[model samples]
Target chain A: MSSERIITVRALTRVEGEGALHVRLDGDEVEDVRLSIYEAPRFFEAFLRERSIEDVPDLTARICGICPVAYQMSSVHALEAALGITITPTIRRLRRLMYCGEWIESHSLHVFLLHAADFFGCASGIELARQFPQQVNDGLQIKQAGNALLEVLGGRAIHPVNVRIGGFHRLPAAGELTALLPKLREARSAAIAAADWIAEFEFPACEFECEWVALTHPDEYPMNAGLIGSTRFPAIEVDEFEDHFEETQVHHSTALHATRRERQTPYLLGPLSRLNLNRDRLRKPAREIAQRLLPQRVIHNRFLSIAARLVEIVHCLDEAIESIQDYRAEGEASCRYAARSGRGCAATEAPRGTLYHAYEISDDGRVRRAKIVPPTSQNQRQIETDLAHFLPAVLDQPDDQIALSCEKLIRSYDPCISCSTHFLKLTMERR
Target chain B: MNTHSRITAVLGLGSPHGDDQFGWSVVDALTHCRRALPSIHVRLVKLRHPIDVISWINDQTQVHLIDAAVGCPIDQVLRLRCKVPTEWRTIECLPAKGTHDLSLGTVLGTAESLDKPIESVTLWLGPAQQCSPIQLMSARTAEAVDACARKLEQTIRGAGPLADPNSHLTPQSVPPSARAGAVTRAEDFDGEMPDSRIDLER
Candidate 1:
């Protein structure tokens, strides 16, 4: 029998981007666990400096192929704040509708293709498809519906070219928007079924009392814009984000780990946090689904995140239908703005979590400085913390099973390491 | 059957990473010559995940995947026929070096299980020498991109008269090299190709 052992998973599967897990064990006691993010830095912030402010939306959207709209939305909102431009109600509606497309597409992908495999005891979607053909087919169809919605509004699904600083470069014609209703209606049923399916899965027994943070809005479930709120802290304005949260560099990872400045502790974000923070704001169908599946107003189970994502998909589909029904194409696609020398910050809930962007623009329209705090970076510390708490229970299990459980926990966050470090290589060892 | 009637799909599976972009460039080149080639119905798709090609396989008779593979000699391009699996099982195949977690064989296996298998599948692989984070495409990969495109066009044109363009091909009848088993390099093709030992379906 080994006295001391190290378990490392070289490349974790299913999740977007690359990352590894390292666990040091002494006899039956878990000594240390580190979720090291080895993705290479792409210097996005440094590249943003001196670039034209007008080009920010398209340029920043390249950060994550999975959630390009999130990057575009956060960047545009920050630049608009700097320029002191208020878009019209119609433009706002269109932006929200676009955001709905992203949420539905991204959430569906995570639930069906990525996270669902773990529950079925499969390594990838291919394995899951072999066992549950109908389920995988339904998931693929649901994903297609989401992609179709994106194509209608954004021209192309991945790295959409239609979004601009003030608004979309070209708004979907009324007929174009109306045509998507039938598919969305069908997808609503599929999403509801997905929620129920995931709810039936046997989840691991684990809970951690940590700070749950997300954007909160009075009238709607936050997406495009909102005040940042945490279970422990009051809501703060977008501009006050840097004042409350700080990003610190760690030696093991290329991505910066974020923490609440005052408490200096990790906080949770993403679907679970968002749902916990704003369950009441969900629309009728989604609210009912959440009530049936979750029951509790505040959920602490990380594994129930798949259920949360499905509910959010239902909400987004319903919201998109409503927005399209109320659409009137009266305003210009984008509002014109002149460059001004000022600093601006804005936060929007990316599919993974709250994505914050801040920019200082020069009078000549060039970017003087830029800061982008992706949700993955914000959740890194919390992920590490979760791993530390999670390892103790699984220490007695076989090495492979323990590694699988750890991978599942990390995937629950749906962490998009690509958005932060731009790369990931996973390694696991036992000695 | 009209010799001109056949559905051919060229899928580019890659990211914006250096040399990885070679696949996209090959597809782009094929698309540029779309109008000149009236005999073939060409559909082009850019994919982030290898599994995404599964959806595009349903209606097409033949699918050509162009991607960058590690271990191949620099500036060299290799054409290999992919072996589609007959029995459905969990795909535990390892992906090519520098590729995503899911391998192309696993995706094809999953597609077959879903009853959407394509009759003929080919891989036009360019050697990936430089695959850094920020770099777009290495000069060697850039050169191989156009050459691979031209070779693909030549092969499609030389594939002889179509035998029942609309007929569904049984798995056993697929050419020996393109049959459902193991990926094998084209023995009779030109170019300085190295012995390939990468197991696509494990």
Candidate 2:
């Protein structure tokens, strides 16, 4: 008779928000794995109803402190689509610049502070800093450069008060944009070095088949606007997102787990997904690094996502510098639009992954309904599936070792539990 | 680039809501009193997260951190002068919870780990209750905030010779009257100090 064992992590640390993981095992066989997101539903979507359409961007921006710009971008773009407003070319470039700041800040924090410690077996980011003070300092400086960009562009670093429905409430001065050039240049160089350094770290050998999903743009790497592109399909309009994808409420988690309607299986998103779908659109330096380090056209190794984040960091810094150099206050700060009843949807590539927002505006410009699908929620199901596949090899180890391995895998996804319930304690049972 | 400069940063950590706003109120008071002591180069910064204290610590040799503490008797002010910054977790008055995962303890630990240029750390904590998220600050907490601010103001005023890079301004550096009610650590308290890791979830 095989013995029954269960491993449970009551509360997971080092990740954002509250969550737990449970694994059930019978002898050598993996019975079940669940990434339980226990945080209460924040009801952002429900509360957004009946609010004025103009307030959607600001209101939604409060959803997540770490990725406020992404929320603002998705909400504003979706609202603009609903209002039928075409932003000017300069406004579009500025939006991209704001996104560059967000990506650099969010990705840098995850790469160095949250995720890197796992690779070194360090207990915390502080422990990692103790050993690699220079790396941690570099990361903080890079993050500060991003924060400076955000403060200048969006009016504040966290939950920017400047973003409006059509465009910015105020434009940055040329000097303000020019001032960021030196910092952005330094960050780009640091990011390139970090990427090369991370690439040399030994990743745990594991790969599982899952569809890669991301927003794809023809002219540039996707940020503000794009069509939904996946490895299994060509491309679909943001309007067609619901027709292809579905978010289902799982019993174990408060967050809605996403899946393809056709297959009803977990798919992947985030840095790896974006890299796989849009590698060619990367900025020249990022592309060169990606080519040299990651030569493969499609990267299935989820652990390499850290490397992907660093690559994107380098890319965003380069993009930010270029945008600042070419910036000008052209036309009006915002586009002119009138209120009318319409529905629109938009997807922007957030630091973690694609963030989709759909809004229905009343003729009087009040929001009738709001649906926001944060990247963390979309990735939750895939995390469970990945854990199930990845746990078998480490099953022979002690329960604590197994739990640590599971935590390492989950952190690799950098699941923001707070965002996902809009979503790991780990439990392993052997029978 | 003078690494030896004596820059004293008084960082007030608090949220905008209810008694949690105690730190901000004290900082606001100090900002008003700043002009009175123009000779002292004390920088006052209001922060929402403890980790943000790191950014201001880079150039400063001496630092004062002000925050509100729950689970203690209201109107009482607690002070801890960190001789060893990494032992911040030993303070029972510290609200173990952080803005996300970065608590004051964690921030102090990180600062020590990074070896930031700092000479001394004085943490001033005011007793807080009813830290309601959206409600205005409680009256008692506001009174406590004022008292703490006055004490800090006197201490900052007494910290002279701002031009001297080697000079340090700790709470003990001032006269006994400036730190009359301040306790050295949780162990010295006449009353029972709660666990340092006060699980807020409970």
| Local error of candidate 1 at residue A205 (angstroms) | 0.9
* TM-score, cand. 1: 0.88
- lDDT, each prediction: 0.74, 0.76
* Model 1 chain A: lowest-lDDT 10 consecutive positions: A422-431
Model 2 chain A: lowest-lDDT 10 consecutive positions: A416-425
**How does model 2 fare in lDDT?**
0.76
On a 0 to 100 scale, what is the lDDT of residue B6 in model 1?
A: 58
The TM-score, computed over Cα atoms with residue i paired to residue i, of candidate 2 is 0.87
Per-candidate TM vs. native?
A: 0.88, 0.87
Error of model 2, residue A84, in angstroms: 0.6
Give residue A82's lDDT in candidate 1 (0 to 100).
Answer: 91
**CA RMSD per model (angstroms):** 5.1, 5.5
Off by over 4 Å in 1: A26-29, A422-431, B1-7, B60-62, B73-75, B82-100, B154-202
